[model samples]
Target: MSTIVIKRSQAVWQDRTRAYTAWVDGKAVGRLEHGASLSVPVGAGEHEVQMRIDWCTSPALSVSVPVGGTVELECGPNANALLALLYITLWRHRYIWLKPATTE
Candidate 1:
C-alpha cells in the first residue's frame, strides 16, 4: 500500500474551526481541520482525491502513487472570507482547492 498526505492551511478567516471531509475515489477516508492534516492509505496506483464541506467541494484531482511510496497534497478554501459567500452559492465546485503540494 501507499500513503497520501493531505494538509489544510490555517485560514483564520475561512472555515476557521471546522473539518473538511477527505474523499478518495468517492469514499470518505478522513477529515482535515484548519492547519491540520491527515494520511490515507490506499493501493499504489492512479486515484482521485477531493475535499468537501457539506455541498461545497474541490474538483477531483488525479494522482498516481508509486509502489510503497507516498504523495502529498494540500487544500484550503479557494476564496477568502469576504468572497466565501459567492464561492459557495455561485461556484460550489470551486469553493475549495485540492492539488499536489508541489504545485502551490
Candidate 2:
C-alpha cells in the first residue's frame, strides 16, 4: 500500500470564494480551500483524479503510484487572462488546471 498526497491550493487569489472538491475514482475524497491540502492512501496502481467547482471540472488526470510511493498533485484556477476567466464562468467551462506539484 502507498499514499497519494493530493495537495491543492486556491492559487488564484481572485477565486478564493469557493472551495474546490477533489474527486478520486468518482468519489468525493476531500474539499480543498485556499492554501489547503489533502492526503489520500491508495494501493499501488493507477488512479483517476479531478477537481470540481460548481459545474466546471478539471480534466481527468491519470496517475500511477508505486508501492510505498507518493504522488503530489496541485489544482488552481487558470487565471492567466480575462478571456479565460470569462470562458470558465460564462460557458461553464473548466478553467482549473491540475498538474504534478512541484517541490520547492
Tell me how candidate 2 scores on lDDT.
0.79
- Output the worst ten-in-a-row residue range by lDDT, candidate 2: 85-94
lDDT of 2 at 59: 79
RMSD, model 1, all Cα superposed?
1.6
Q: Output the TM-score of candidate 1.
A: 0.93
Per model, state how many residue pairs clash.
Answer: 0, 0
Off by over 4 Å in 2: 10-12, 89-93
lDDT of 1 at 30: 91
Compute the lDDT of residue 26 as modeled in candidate 1. 91
Per-model RMSD to reference:
1.6, 2.2
lDDT of 2 by residue, 65-92 (tens): 8999999998887655656657477645
The whole-model lDDT of each prediction reads 0.92, 0.79
